[model samples]
Target: MTISTTRKLVGVSAAAGLILALAGCGAAPTSNPTGSSGGPTAAASFKPCIVSDSGGFNDHSFNEAALTGMQEAAKQLNVQFRQVTSKSASDYTPNMQALVAGGCTYIVSVGFNLSAATIASAKANPKIDYAIVDDPADANNDGKTDAPNIKPLLFDTAQAAYLGGYAAAAWSDAHGTDKVGTFGGMQIPPVTIYMDGFVDGVNKFNADKHKKVQTFGWNVATQKGSFTGAFQANDTAKQTAQGILNQGTDVILPVGGPIYLSAAAAIRDSSKGTVMLGVDSDFVLADPSVKDIVLVSIMKRIDVAVHDAVMAGASGKFDPTTYIGTLKNGGVGLSPFHDFASKLPAGLTDELKSLQQQIIDGKIVVQSKATPKAATSN
Candidate 1:
């Protein structure tokens, strides 16, 4: 890949500053700091906070990605920030309330599970700026955010997932199986978007290669398939992955957060020779334990987006503009093949690059009903 194309693929340069700032990030503050370094004088009192979903910040997924951004923001601004981890859905409101009570100037709720609580908090406290990850915050289905204070941090993951799906299908075809599968954490829009893109990618591969590759877990037409119903790495997730693997699938895409761990375990135990795909964050780098079995990750630059949003808020530039991650920008794309690079088919890498450009050029439209609108792609 060329320099510009590599930048678009995984947002390496966009995230470099945040990664550098992470070295100076301290633990959650017991009390707010006195002043900030890289902001206006009024920003001395700016206190940003974050709350994680049930998966906590150690899920090696979106929650962790968001926390990384928050830490980087705090470090660069030279301010202390607070954080809360939710054990279940019920803790969302209470967590947001605690942050509000702590006099947080800007709060970020990580994940779609906290959308309701984020909207409620934003509505109740109009002075505070809020941002939500992986949700549009369209509580009434009116196709807009419910509150002005809340900024929607959404990702067009389907575009990147299509690339992943096509790569998986090609890998399976090269292995002579021509069978792939996918399962999600839940039936929600964020989860299903990946499945939808994967389905289309496999169809594209079949049409292009004139081969019959079967997708086992997800059915795009009926919008029904296997799901663990939760984003936990547990027995249910493992069993769901095993069920997909039992169908003789050569590759499987698990759409949940930490559920990919269970799928990785399933891949390791069985003799199916099945590889897995990751979502949100790169699994191979996030958790090296699954590096051997993972093919590639459909990555959304959540950390970079979160950092930019938090920085803007700290500098008194908070806007409710919806940020959409797409292939055109460095927002969403696939990770490198890593160890699996040598195992791929000869021309597969070049083909994926061409397809990515095609998608960016609007030649290949990866459609999904769950795609976010009014997108300010960055």
Candidate 2:
């Protein structure tokens, strides 16, 4: 299948409509509410709860996306929901335990850092249904990646980041620069998966166009890259982005939640016409302040996955099947160019579309060690 054909197959218009509808879903409750206003009362017997990582619900990334899903499920399914925010790594277990103690019927833990705690909780409370975002909840502490009561929401983000990288490279090349760069919040698999695919996409662009585009902040061979010590430290993220910009990078991809805000600030303040690429959630939609600087976004569709999982669990069809977001499944993809659409070089958009199709068709393989294999039925 070609790029145009793929778009037609995916029903881009319909997807956009669904996204807009979801955007209008009731905002996530700041704290646990008894029931949604103007919506049906949730059955007291069924409660869906979420535990956010340190990023919190307003991080405008994966954590926020997961919460958004829960909120939407509350509105659509008439299910009561609640959420807990983790202030630090130590809070994972306590927060989860608190939710369990509160009689949460299904608990969803966001982020991989909570894997061990989530696994332990799932094992200890085998009767309660559980789902984890961005990880396979291995209940037995075994290497094999599966658990009967836990659903893993994983995304092949490399597939989408690859497209973002290619577009960034093309944009850089068009502007008479061969410099692009990426940085992460941490070195975890979920974070590095994006950087790995980005670097590879830049390499692919270099090879296909016979141009020498340079990538910074990440080295696939060395398995090393630049990172902010913490996900929520905007000051550190800004400093890192400024340092990278000083090195002459005009296209920057920050593979963290709100850290991209720092990069956006740096780009805006530098007055260098630099652009940014967002991860997990579309920064353009999540934060209007960064819309001008975000050329495109590597969307992970976490909200959709979360909503589907909640619906499944509510309808009594919950299973251990891992939901792997891939290009073929509309699980991950690049967002519309938005303001940057008209600014791209001639044919650059077409080139990106073609590259996406190539990846989907197996003509181009976007691989990362962090890529999670689909779960097998036991």
Q: Best candidate per TM-score, number? A: 1
Give candidate 1's whole-model lDDT. 0.81
Candidate 2 TM-score, true structure as reference: 0.88
| Weakest ten-residue segment in model 1 by summed lDDT | 18-27
Q: Write the per-residue lDDT of candidate 1 for residues 1-378, one digit (tens) a residue.
A: 122432432334433422111211111212133364444333878999999988889988889988987886687677889999998899999999999999999999998889899989988999999999989888777777888888888888899889888899999999848889999897888899999999899899889899889999888889899999988999999999999998899899999888998998898899667898888877877888988888888877777678778878987878788888777766777877778888899888778877887887799999887787753312
Which ten residues in a row are the worst by lDDT in model 2? 18-27
lDDT at position 106, candidate 2: 90
Give all candidates' CA lDDT scores.
0.81, 0.78
Best candidate according to lDDT: 1
- Residue 94's lDDT within candidate 2 is 98
Superposing all C-alpha atoms, what RMSD in Å does each candidate have to the true structure? 5.7, 5.3
